[model samples]
Target: MSSQSSTQGAALAPEKRETFSSRKLFILSAIGSAVGLGNIWRFPYVAYENGGGAFLIPYIVAIFCAGIPLLFLDYAIGHRYRGSAPLSYRRANRKTEIIGWWQVLICFVIAIYYAAIIAWAAMYCWYSVTKAWGNDAEGFFYGEFLNTADTVGVSFDFVPNVFFPMLIVWIFTIVIMVAGVNKGIARANAVFMPLLIVMFLILVVQSVFLPGAIDGLNAFFTPNFDALQNPAVWAAAFGHIFFSLSVAFGIMVTYSSYMKRKSDLTGSGYVVALANSSFEILAGIGVFAALGFMAYNANSSVDSVVSGGIGLAFIAFPTIVSAAPFGALIGVLFFGSLVFAGLTSLISILEVIVAAFQDKLGWGRVKATLIVSIPVAVVSLLLFSATTGIYLLDTIDAFVNQFGILACALVMVIVFGSGLGMLPKLAKHLNRHSSIKLGTGWMVLVGGIGPAVLAYMLINEFQAKITEQYSGYPAWFNGVFGWGLCGLLIVVAGLISLIPWSKNSKLEDPEYDQHQQNVQAEAVPETVSKEY
Candidate 1:
């Protein structure tokens, strides 16, 4: 299809589509999405485990090569097609619509469990002030707080502590999502991102001054260059970068769809990338310094106390809060940061799902927001309120990150590049209005190296998951929630894509009205577009 014809839908729907009011707001919102809860807990351990300070090598390489370039690709598609993930892909190419729906489903799964984590963070923020965990932080988290089940399975018994907060989270999210893009999403990021940074900075400084902080810093910065030789290190960098930057998940695509025409697409992406990486590095410094204090308190090494994800956030950090000087302050800052970060990222995830359905059904923003979000909220509440919630969360998170996200990303890149031969077309769209021009190099990195790295990471993940049980969860549980759920998304997304788009949708024979004609006249011609 010609680029002009492919992009005609966007021109027809200018009033219907909401955009970020300014480039500055767009950058802030983008950074808010990228600098998620993982930036604090997961990144520090990922850096320390992969190569300590030496991990910076592949980390930078991954961000510049895979992360930012892919960001621009999302920008191109969304900005050009002017729709949500499904609508954007449908506009880009009819056959690729399934990829977009798959993203929405992934977001759906993530939002369901993700709310629980944010609720945990909110509770922990209060617990920080009270030091509610008492003497045994780990025991309090696993036993007293969660009231976790003994085995890996689903249950109906509810935990009020989890249920209430999860409910509150959903209510707050619904309010924000219903408010629409400019009023809700942009404003929330404007509020949350700065607050997160300030709280985190104070926390980092406080942790650094605490006893044994230098030891943690040393442990973090101390490089084992020999680790660089391991392919796993590079893979770790690529994997973390992918998750960290929120690339290829229909997020950037949806967010960028809101950018004003003639916006500096690539330049803004570079800024978002830089801010995100800088935040992660800052997180590493703060987190490791506290872990060092934890090690010192235990009369042990930093390596012993070092961990990531839920353990680090819930168990390890809480222990640090109990032991470190100004511990209450540390707890508040750290946990509060989690709340802010998680909320922003969760907003982005839900937006992907909400926007997809909104565009597909051509429903009003408020109507779509309620119809989609309420059901998702109900599901999240029911599943995550149970005693078995943690078990299910852990298994589902593992599968989604490994199988769902990684596999889907690889397929999207392949289909867009070699399978459809659309890189040339995409690259042209990016360079036309973008301040930072892209040519063959951007094409090669996104189309070639990007796939190679993702393919390698996916292969490694599949091999490890297939050969061994993930997190020692039961085989049945893994098969049902983990592998089973991932496969289910693909089939469901395919079936949904086959359903005819509502006549109200842009996909249904959009008229080539005067607005579209004017847009085409102003747009750079597609005279140069061709299959790659």
Candidate 2:
């Protein structure tokens, strides 16, 4: 508020915005973003449905051929250009600026609902102490806890149980966002990432000692090689790897934009990729082990109790905790891990939007953080804190992730592959920055193989959607909420791009210019001539 402070803030240079203090911080922050609730709740069921242990084959293949390659692309662009996704894309191809906005908006939409889920984790963290969901976890989650009304539309009917904790979740996220990149986001990941792993290890160690531990591990790892022949199973494998690695969203681009010039971009990508998948395997072991105990108690097989998404985390896991020895302590640790994982991911989502504002409008970090965080917090508190919150979250999440994020990723792959002919140049840029240099194999995977898989995913989803409603939800629900929002996101992104870019914006840093010069000189195709 003082004149000197005001002058300093207004005069802040673009280079002074923020960066990860160390390579360790960068890797951990990215891993935290990728290893969200989905890796734990969704991957186990995806594996179970797609041939259990045999699913690892497709999952690993998808990672090497699709996930890690796209990750390198994101890292190369962000680190080379030192801008948010939109700015970075504009730098790649001025015409593809809208693609960057599209991805950034998708991150914004995801952040809104994602914060609400973290709030649920936060509340469950407290509820664990007394087994507050009581003996019937499912009923408590739908009835007493969420008080979820049986409706497809939004309502003003608020649920105090969900509202208060969600408020705290938003508040905590805002404080961290306001703390700036190194001091807040990176530092928070440095702490929570370790705690999350330690707590999960405790749960897994305790779980294997349970009476049905072997049964659970068998259910998870038991291979069904025949399932690999099914295209749907292979599709599931690609989808899981796509969402799990956080490539489609702008989170990786935004996070990597903060890395120092000499950092190893490709090496860091591999590190984050392995760390994320490693956590998924660890979660499978702990989650299935606990579910094994639940099935044992009910005189059922692991197959009988197996479910995914909210059911696995809120219902199945809680049921296991209540029946296990030392239920309360285990419950606290489990839900606490969810809170940490979800919180770290939520910060990354918010940073994507904040970075966009800072890069385009030349706003300072605090101003950008407050501008974006305040309204989003209000929306989360109001939009997803009602009796119908659970249903609304389900519809929106399915719609946004499938159509919004996946579609953007496909566009990016095409733009880099053939449209702009920049995939070769981007790979060259990556090799320039990384010690472990990539070759033509990286280009083929990202430009050709990756796009082919993504196109198949989009087409597969379209074919299924045309024939039947997703999840057996009402046709009207799928139409209005699912497809309608996907279309709207594109329109909104176009409108966002129409906003006047900051004239005073400076992308003329010597290092930024030098990186571009070297990339163009190395292997840029003759067909690609545009320069940002």
Candidate 3:
């Protein structure tokens, strides 16, 4: 075979020539990606809004029912194929590769907006150091940062002041991606994730010591059954599970594709989920406790303590920090931790697209990293320039978090739950050494109940948004148009699947199988695959 044909043949194989990442590195990278700014900033605000402490029930339920099972599904698919999103799904089932590719595309869009948000966090961290948030910090932040074009009549401008910090974020993300899985992403996570945990623990400890910290903790942990009546609560819980676990974006798949054959999928999945949930719980205790203290100090209601989007981190958090004892030092640590978490997740998202470029386009990994980084950096610079950039960011955040991710995840559940028969096989692969196996219960969750709940949430959310027209929504915010646009994008992506591979060979073509066997024989030792 010619070199080009050989490369195409390997791509068509179910198994390809690739090195397995160390299990330790795999766990660290996955955990790093999961424990992001969402766990710290978004989760607390969302939990407070939905039910304060009440949202935990559905959130935890969603984790086991959907999060854990889907994680295993992604891991199984990636490890089996040893390829990135599109190729992994193509190997598993050719027809569903379109669904997988759509997931990757969503990740790309998310990465663009996500880079902008990361830049915001980095800017906040820098401001904290510069002491730019002077007296009346909250007022200044509300006026200068949170207020939108509609609210303040200021048009967005992409100036050098904002673009420079964004450039830093992009550069940092690229450096991690260029290093590949082990030495770069995994190692950085191992170091930074632990530091984040330590900082959060410190904050939690300090928060519990506050005057009303116990009361705050009580309110957050106590169950409020009334929250169950609101469909928004269920929707928020479901969305959090999907976003927190980093599912449906091809991120988990890309990360897992680097895992060693002998890596423990069940163990890794459980650990990632547990670690992520623990961070949420800890963040809630810290945030609500501080908020409780703040409310007492300001003579405000608990509801007054709640904030969302960038305001939670920049405005609300700064207010809380300023009131705390030794507030400046604490603020620095907290925001610094947030920056670390955001950057870690940012790296993973960027890596997914970079990996796709390298695997499909045959670009060198380093070269692909730089190529993807440039556009991401430029777009993020534009996004940050919106005088209403914060508002625009919030909209994109909701669209991606609430709609895009849910849409992608729904497709994933349908594809794996129905199109692919790999769930049971995956459970067996994951549970090979474990005493506990995800049995019929998991199958029911992934295949039937999970998708049903997702569909219900989507429909109910759409209806609710339609009924509630806020003054702030743009003229273009028509519900039917938005849903149709999303649907069209997904369908267009699926149509791309029908196009034949330029190489004109099926995955099961004999030549491809032979190439895989040859590559496997030469690269991976039999003992490695057999080893635990």
Candidate 4:
């Protein structure tokens, strides 16, 4: 066989291949990573908070205009380079790889807190089966999960049960990575994703049957033009689209690096977007419908029944589930689906860290996975500590998800969208075989409008912090903790950027001859040669 065909065929062999993800498997795994608890638990609340049904306007627009283009960009970059985010970014543009590292850094922070949240979901799943959460759903959660007193005073508690489950989660993640992609991640997604969809459909059906469901549905779908007119609402909608789709982060880049050359990224991009948005719509229907029922029964506004943070899941969801027929069964299924979703995403995030370790430190995949898992596991153990531990998790989650991600995303836009002269090259590659070709229009969006909006969001986010510090918190606690944490993260990221290793890095420019040779080798027709 020709050298190129030989490599392609070798990739199919289980024993010889280093990374064994197929085009089919890549798509499935990508879908699994993208569709998660965020779609079910978070999106509903965000949709409700923003503009209700009116949110869909900006949301749909963002998907096409922003989300899909970025998704394809990551895929094209990754598949072409056949490396993880750090390597892909460096391979694309050596100097610009620093920006990619920033994205990787964000994923690392997210993995710490994200795993904790997943642990919470696993705990809920266990409780569902054990019936530990009795009919007094809200009380059980607040008393057991959210309220504990220790040195930190009244705060959340990290039970041993929660921590142990997280260990299982970490183990599960490593095993999937060890399985070499196709057999592990792909097979897992093939099984779990369908189950997620089925459960969602069943919940939607059940929710619609609940009395006052229409009121919730109407509230969710009905556009509030007033809210739509607000620029902040539009920004929120766009940001949610970006965050929920898992763009800006290097996860998509890493995942796509495993794709076969012939993979139709534009087609797969559409599939991922459709599947993701459908989950959001389904989640909105499920959540608001349940809220509508709750409102009708309680004779109050839906807002009264709503709560934020983990309370929404641990408290509000369980309360809603208890009122339904076969409550325990449904609760089990819902939380089970959540565990699956979170696990899938967690695996992708951890893979980014593992890949970086392997590329930078020259460690083998197994060694890298184990090495990364150890420190993460050790830190994650803190989440099991008494009251103080839970507070740390909350603070970490907010700081990382809100600030770190936004910061990394802005840097990525600046680097990929502006710093490196890859926009024209990217547009050309994206347009080459793409059914929906992205062009100069996308360049303007990513380089100009996208960055401006991301900057505005970051500023607003920090301003919100300031407002909360001065006016929202108690005098003693004001500005002390929150600002300190934010400042620390900033310092850490800045120090990372200054490291000598990043200063002289050389990234392979995608438009260069070497890159073209690599792409041509991979994309060559199967019938062209079989002689090696």
By TM-score, who's the top model here? 1
Q: Over 4 Å off in model 4, which ranges?
A: 1-21, 129-131, 150-158, 470-532
Instruction: Point out the worst 10-residue segment of candidate 3 by lDDT.
Output: 523-532
Name model 2 segments beyond 4 Å from true. 1-15, 507-511, 514-532
Ten consecutive residues with minimal summed lDDT in candidate 4? 502-511
List model 3 lDDT by residue over 120-189, tens digit each: 6666766765556676667666555534444522255654445666777778778878887777888888
lDDT of each: 0.89, 0.85, 0.71, 0.71
Best by lDDT: 1
Residue pairs in candidate 1 whose N, alpha carbon or C atoms collide under 3 angstroms? none
Report the lDDT of model 3 for residue 462. Answer: 64
lDDT of 2 by residue, 231-304 (tens): 98988998999999889688888888899866888889999999999999999999898888888989899999
**TM-score versus the correct structure, for each prediction:** 0.94, 0.93, 0.86, 0.86
Greater lDDT among 3 and 4 belongs to 3
Clashing pairs in 4: 1-530, 1-531, 1-532, 2-530, 2-531, 94-507
TM-score of model number 3: 0.86
